[model samples]
Target: MTTTVNQVMTSYYDAYNSEDPDRLAAVLDDSVILRSAAGTGQGLPGYLDTYRTMITTFVDRMTPQRIEADGDTATVSIVNTLTARADVPDFMGMKLKAGETLTLNLRGRYKVRDGRISEIDIELA
Candidate 1:
């Protein structure tokens, strides 16, 4: 059986929590798009690369708090807490801590097609 949108979202979050790029890729369409407060990506591979970098270099974990769907669209509410590993610029480009836990509220919208995520719109809370 094919995966449902909810299952895809759950798997995506699980992949994220696992910090595994290959796992993250499994739930996304090849042409998946990600739009967020941090800009956007055109494909799943690029998104996976970004996630891999974030997980390896900056973030420690990202957890989904809730999920809801309306037709083919679904929203995943998540809480991401990151532990800085290097001196990285903040959202405004200001240099920040090398090791600090930063909590961010996130909401991501998934557009599903053929049981895969085709588009994702994300925002910071």
Candidate 2:
């Protein structure tokens, strides 16, 4: 059976919060593209690299405030809370020291193909 867009997005967020690169990659297409203020990444390898960096640098948690899906597309409003694991001199224009926490309100537009996420465009909410 084919997965619905909502199911794909739910799996994506669950994988992200799990902080397992392998789990997150499972929900992504091989050629997935992710665009955000931090940077843009293409392909599974690039995406995994970004995920590793973020998890290593901070304790990150993504909480979905709203999720709306139609056909193969999904739009999600999220609250991302990050507690620095190490001093980050600059992160998306913010500086954080170890033990410090920062929260961001974000919106993400996702495109799903087959049962995987193909593209994600993220921005500040």
Candidate 3:
């Protein structure tokens, strides 16, 4: 398939925008791997599950600020403001409480295969 970088990126964003794990899964390769500034995971599903759990933990809404793609890769820059619903350990291991909004700048990179992401690397920007 002649999948362009833009198409793959659009699929990835659509999956995230929908917040549907199944939809996200549809665009992930079975053997996908992910590495973040926080940590790394073995597969795409596991990576998605971890973030989903975090969203349930203390995040209210997440928004993307920008996205860029070239060849078989894409990068999404995001500004995420999260409200702590309960005391949770952040990346810095601080105790955060409800109603506290933590703003973070993040960059995520995707490696695509057949219009699906087979690997990802994320970092704090």
Candidate 4:
């Protein structure tokens, strides 16, 4: 398969939204680092643990508004729909009540290495 930065990003989101850690891992380097408002995770195991928490804590979906790629780097602007699960954790400086939902604009900057994601940094919009 031909691997492009866009393809890598699509794969990353596809795997993430599907809640498939194994597939998600396929697009990341073993030394990958993910940083966000939530927290930071390093390497494959750290990422999987973080994903597990997300799967358990919230039902979230991402809508990409823009994708820009240059060389092995890419940036995506996205709208996120987030709904708290029954047992949700605190986020965005607020305690989530049951069934509470939020819509947020976010951005993700990524770097690719050998057709895999080497780093991702997320920021609020």
* Best candidate, TM-score: 2
RMSD of each: 1.8, 0.9, 2.4, 1.5
What lDDT score belongs to each candidate, Candidate 1 first? 0.81, 0.93, 0.75, 0.86
Which predicted model would earn the best lDDT?
Answer: 2
TM-scores for all candidates: the values are 0.87, 0.96, 0.80, 0.91
Those runs of model 1 whose alpha carbons end farther than 4 Å from true positions after fitting are 92-94
Badly placed stretches (over 4 Å) of model 2 are none
**Candidate 3, which segments miss by more than 4 Å at Cα?**
1-3, 60-62, 89-91
Alpha-carbon deviation at 35 in model 4, angstroms: 1.8
The per-residue C-alpha lDDT of model 3 at residue 102 equals 79
Q: TM-score of model 1 relative to the true fold?
A: 0.87
Residue 45, candidate 2: Cα error in Å is 0.4
Weakest 10 consecutive residues, lDDT, candidate 4? 86-95
lDDT of 4 by residue, 1-125 (tens): 76999988888888888877888889889989999977787898997888788777888787778889999999999888878887455587777776888888999999999999999898998
Candidate 3, residue 39: the lDDT equals 76
Query: Rank order by TM-score, top first?
Result: 2, 4, 1, 3
Ranking by lDDT: 2, 4, 1, 3
Candidate 1 local lDDT, 26-82, one digit each (tens): 888899998977788989778887787787678667788888988888988889888
